[model samples]
Target: MPDAPPSAAPVEESTEDWRRRNVGRLLNEAVRRFESRVLERLAEQGFHGVRLAHVGVTRNLDVAGTRPTELAYRASMTKQAMGELIGQCVDLGLVRREPDPADGRAKIVRFTDQGLHFLEHFRRAVVAAQGEMGENLGEERVRALLETLWDYVHPDGT
Candidate 1:
């Protein structure tokens, strides 16, 4: 293969230049775009207006079937807000609250069979959306980038 001319070479960026460029802001914009794309695709797949926050709660429920208080802590949400959201999910038949064995005072929120089915559909939509993005950058690079961001976001452990 023939080497490219020097005039076409990649630009060398100084640390100071990169710092002044607001890279974090840029990354935040990229994330927003990614999220918008995913939501659009989900709608196209018949899940209109299904906010990503709902998926977060489902993901949390899957990992830890906990009381509302514990879920709020894990999800970094205010208890009142979590309760409201969980109530909405319950109304939608996306989740259920069962009496907590450890603490009868609190009910553990869990995914119902319907919620599990919806979660699976959500997973497929997310996977397809990510795969579409990965077509441009490759899946490995996207995965590594996400992992690196997670490391910074949850430095203490999530």
Candidate 2:
């Protein structure tokens, strides 16, 4: 039989901690859990087919339609990566690609009629999830958390 791995020994210094958890990791985990809760609420409301991966497209998307480059910038992903997600959205009947009016060479990503409906569901899902979080963590705490994160994200409040 294979031997088990050695057990982790607690380190005296936090920097020497084996777990290696940190601020960025905590923030990433919180965002993921929040989105997962949103997805659960969406599914409970009879909305399906939407998945976490779609957030990269849907969350950054402008209602008036936006170019993939702008979406990538907003989502903090590569243009090519967002393009692949956009393709997935197209296949899922969530969005369509159209030639940009002013920029003939670029394409704009717009939601399909179905996608608009999905957007409503997405909005409701997020609110419901946030409500649950507020219930669990107290409304004041939730509000503070949102404000804190927003401040950190946009230090200049532009």
Range of the 10 consecutive residues with the lowest summed lDDT in candidate 1: 3-12
lDDT, candidate 2, 44-147, per-residue tens: 87767778879679988899999999999998989988999999999988899999998999999999998898899899988988998899999999999999
Which residue pairs come into collision in candidate 2? none
Q: After superposition, how far is residue 68 of candidate 1 from its true place, in Å?
A: 1.2
TM-score of 2: 0.84
Give candidate 2 regions above 4 Å deviation. Answer: 1-21
Worst 10 residues of 2 by lDDT: 3-12
| lDDT, model 2 | 0.85
Best by lDDT: 2
